[model samples]
Target chain A: MRALCWHGKNDIRYEQVPDPVIEHPRDAIVRVTSCAICGSDLHLYDGFMPGMKSGDIMGHEFMGEIVDVGPGINGKVKVGDRVVVPFTIICGECEQCRRGNFSVCERTNRNKHIADKVFGHSTAGLYGYTHLTGGYPGGQAEYVRVPYADVGPVKVPNGLSDEQVLFLGDIFPTGWQAVVQCDIEPTDTVAIWGAGPVGQFCVRSAILLGAQQVICIDRLPERLAMAEAGGAIPINFEKESVVERLNDLTNGKGPQKCIDAVGLEAHATATIDSMYDRAKQAMMLETDRPHVLREMIYVCRPAGTISVPGVYGGLLDKVPFGMVMNKGLTIRTGQTHVNRWTEDLLGLIEEGQIDPSFVITHRVPLERGPEMYQTFRDKHDGCIKVVLQP
Target chain B: MQNAYGNHSGSSRAHGVARGLGWFSIALGVAEVAAPRALTRALGMDGQESLVRAYGLREIATGSAILRSENPAPWVWGRVAGDALDLATLGAGYRNQNPQQQRNLGLALAAVAGVTAADVWCARALSNGAGQQARLPMRDYRDRSGFPRPPAEMRGAARHLSIPRDMRAPEALQPYRAG
Candidate 1:
């Protein structure tokens, strides 16, 4: 099977690997039809998250047809069943999965010992992510061995194109969960940082969930414009002050809910704290940049909520915990429990309320995944999302 | 708005040069700090060791600023100014220098001249925005909202959706409430 493999920092290759087989009784072999380069994948591409081995397959957002299933799967999933595999690999029967906290599912991470040492407790296993999660070969290939196949792959009904259902495996539900965790009220103004794909979804999700006003912040003109189209007031942080503009929009009060979709790789170049982070990062003194996190803590309304759908790894320097404490902020953050919201989001897609395909700015063959990684990382050619046809 | 680095290569290359220069600055500064006596002895400026160390501190500060700052133009310009001061100090030592000392001073002056040229060039490139500034796009995307209807009508369209109890904010923080 041809797959995208991780070599080192900033190096992804399209190479041939052995085909996958049913590894366990509950496992399934999926022949990938479509995949995407996600923002979090950039974290791995940039070599931020550790534990990735050489030649490890690289992808998480993908959907395809099942070619084979283990005997334990029984008839729940059969061959030729089209499905979108959620990024998180879940055992379905774990306590966390039972509680709908699938991102923290107790039983899926094969690397639980390593994760326990690093994270105090292991979270759910994820595809094509680092070994800290399950080092499961991801869906970026022609075929992938899904460890907990029956639990994670949501069956896609016929008539829905791969584009419409693809993101249900990740970004669509991720954005949805980011907003749902905000618990938005009708009169609340929601401020989201980062206008990337997840951020775009955050805008649409916030609106659909009934926030009174949605503000999307980014330095990119095209992304901000897209956010505007999605019923969000676009704030180009490079042009005007985010703090002042957000305050002006909210009548001198800060936004009631803030979402940091930018995560570890925030690019607030003009700010002193970002400079500090870059300096520390270059010196290997800091692991992640928390510029958006700092700004959110500073600007969120007192007693408001801060929901982070962004991926952050390792230590952050100089976070303003004082502001968070004094303001009485509620910070909710995690990897998305994708399965918990896939059904609702699938209904939304089926109802014609929103189209996840709108986020895909570029589509290409799986072979071009390496170049697409650079194009997407650099945000060249107005590339918001790149969907790969494997 | 037009970004100075239209194609992005120039900006990326400029940042690469700026980073190289930053590391160079720190390396040169460290050399001076650790062995000011060696530099002074070579130049025959026996009493100027302390001054050499002071300039080394300046170099370290400037280098740190360049490496740490997103914009390195001003810091590069600072390097140019520091180069000028170094030349002036070396030239002032020329009056009392012996033949061997003059040769070493001349060599020192040429080395400073070379670095000074790089500093000036890097500074000008950065100031003109031909260097490491972000390349903002001219592509318009105001129409790419993912909604089926106009956003105004679609606002709160998913209100029928339920918010899980654990996910909801405390009652006091809810803006719209039930009687």
Candidate 2:
């Protein structure tokens, strides 16, 4: 099988590897029809996340038809079932899964001891991500081996195209979960940072869930324009002050809901804190950049909710915990329990209430996946999203 | 896709060249700093070792900035400026040198010229690729709201969906309104 493999920092190659086979009783082989280059993948591409070894297959957002299934799946999933594989692998029987916190399902991470030592407890296993989860080969190929397949893959109806449902695997549900966790009220003003794909969805999700106003902060003119299309008031942080503009939008009270969609690589050149983060990160003094986290803590309205869907790998530097404590802020953050929301988002797509495909700005063959990674990471050609066709 | 914003396809090449030049600058700077007296003697500027050491420090700083920055275009331009300073110093040393020293100075001038070309090329390549993002023609996405209805009508469109209890904010933190 031909898959995009990570060689090292900034090196992804489309090369042939041995085909994946059924590995467990609940495992299934999926013939991937489509996949995407996610924002989190850039973390590995830039060598921020630890535990990535040479030749690890790279992807976590993909959808396809089931070509084979293990006996444990039984009638739950069968051959020819079209499905979107959630990035987080979950065992349906776990306590976390029962509580609908599939992202922290304890039984899924094959390397739980390592995760236990690092994160205090292992979370869910993820495809094409770091080995701190499970070092599962990902779906950015012609095919993939999905573990705990019966529990995590969401079957999609035939009427919808791959574009409409592919994001159910990650970003769509991720953005949705970010806004939902904020518990946005009808009168609330939601301020989201980063106008990347997840940020764009955060914009629409805030509006759909009835925030009085949605403000998106980013430096890219094209991304801000897209956020505007989603009914958000765009704040180009490079042009104007994020703190001042967000305050003005909320009548100087600050937004009731704040989200950091930018994660570890938060455009390090923009602000003093971001520049500080860059210096710390370059010197290996800090493993993650917390610029957005700092801004979110500083500017969120008192008693407001801060929802984070962005991925942060390790220790962050100079986070303003004093501000968070003083403001009585509520911080909710985690990997998206993708399966928990996909069924609902799929209905939204099926009912014509929302179409997830609006986020895609570039589509190309899987062979061009390497260059697409560069283009998407650089945000060139008005590129907001790049969906790879397998 | 390629556009006036710059060729996205060649972005990797530009980045690779920029990174390579950054490392080269650092290596050359280390050599000059470690052996400033030798460099001055070779170029027939024996008493100017401190000046050579200062240029070395400048090179190290510029190279460090280039490697550290998310966007290295401005730092690459800094390299171009440093390259000019190197050429000027070498040009000044070209006079009043013995034949062997003069020959070594000419070779040094040629090496600096080659690196200067690379610095300029990398600077422009990095700039042309993404430095104009703010000034580029904004691609309009106003019609792509992803809503079936107009955005105004789509407000609270998913209100019927229930929020999970654990995901919601505490009632104590909820905003209160006057009746």
Candidate 3:
């Protein structure tokens, strides 16, 4: 089988590798119909996130048709089931999973010792991620082995194309969860950072959840245009002061809810704070660049909620704890509990409430993966998202 | 399925040392690819960006082979040869006058040497199966939590065969009995 394997920073290859088989009774083999390259995969591609091994499969956003299943899967799934597998692997029986915290399931992270030291506890097994999560092979290949098949794979209807339902595997759920944390009221105003694919989804989700106004911030014109298409007021931080622009747009009051969709690898202009972060990072003084976190706090209204869907792998330095305490801000974040909302989100897609394939800027064969990684990372060719067909 | 689920069932995905070297190759490869000019200049080999990029590709290729190959021994060997080539190229920079940079290069050389040793060790283990097959964990499919719905759901919109098998368990064989 051919799969996209991570070798190092800025280096990914589509290579021939062994076919996967059922190791557990509940395992099922899915012939991946479509897979997506996520922003989080960039965190791994850029070598910013640690714990990834060489040859680890790369990608989390994918959907496929089940071709084989172990008897352990019993009735949950069988041969020929078309399904969307969530990125987070879970045994529904675990205490955390039972509580609907599928991303932090206790039994999934077999490589618990390293994660225990880094994060103080283990996260649920994530397909194709680093060793911090269980290092399961990702779906960026012809076929992939999915564990806990009955619990995590959502069966999809035939009327929808793979692209339409593919993101149900990760980003849509993540964006929804970010806003759900804010508890937005119909009259509330929302501010979102990064108008990338996830940010576009958040813009729609915020509006769908009843926020009166949604503002998206980014410098890229295409992504800003995408946010505009999604009904968000676009703010170009490169052209104007973000906090001032957001405040002015909201009549001197900051947004009631702020969401940071950009995670660890946020690029900044030549500002003093950004310069400091760049210098500190190059010198190994800090691991994450938390410019968005600070900006989110600065533009958030007093007593409002700050929701982060962005991936932060390690400790962040010099966060404004004083402002958070003084303003009584509520900050909520987690890896998306994908299994918890699979049914609800699937229903949304079924009703034609959303068409996630809108953000797809490029679709190509898996062979183009290596070159496309460079193109997507460079943000060239109006490439907001790239979906690979294997 | 003989070598399924990472060399063998129930074993750690890959040997730790091999995975570590794979990571090392990637880190160094990323540095080379991201800013070849800057990296070559800093290494006192100014005006050699193309050379650095080529090396970056090689590093990435070998690193990928180590990670994805079912028999990673040959790929690990490629890394060993690549390491020697790197040292041979850097031999000129060892004579540079900047003691700080010189010390840094020396530390890099030592690190590479350590990684090369581990690569050799892992290559040997891959040849030996690392005792993985002997300890393969057998699967007991019935221990599963079972499906969330009937088997028909698995078929999606596909036409179903009439009179499919019933999912009910036999009365005497059922694990749980009603009170």
Quantify how close model 3 is to the true structure by its C-alpha RMSD in Å: 17.9
**What C-alpha lDDT values do all the predictions have?**
0.89, 0.89, 0.78
TM-score of 2: 0.86
For all predictions, the C-alpha RMSD in Å is: 4.4, 4.4, 17.9
Model 3, residue A283: C-alpha shift (Å): 1.3
Task: Give each prediction's DockQ, rounded to 2 decimals.
Answer: 0.45, 0.46, 0.02
- Lowest-sum lDDT 10-residue window in model 2 chain A: A267-276
TM-score of each: 0.87, 0.86, 0.70
Candidate 1 overall Cα lDDT vs. reference? 0.89
Candidate 1 lDDT, A1-390, residue by residue in tens: 899999999899999999998779999999999999999999999998999999999999999999999999978899999999999988989788898899999999999999999999999999999999989898899999988787789998998999999999999999989999999888889999999999999999999988899999998788988899899999988789999999999999999999999999998345678867876888899999999999999899999999999999999999989999999899999999999999889999899999889888888899989978977887766879989988
CA-RMSD of model 1:
4.4
> Model 2 lDDT vs. the true structure?
0.89
| Lowest summed lDDT window (length 10), candidate 3 chain A | A268-277
Clashing pairs for model 1 are none
Q: Which CAPRI tier for candidate 3?
A: incorrect
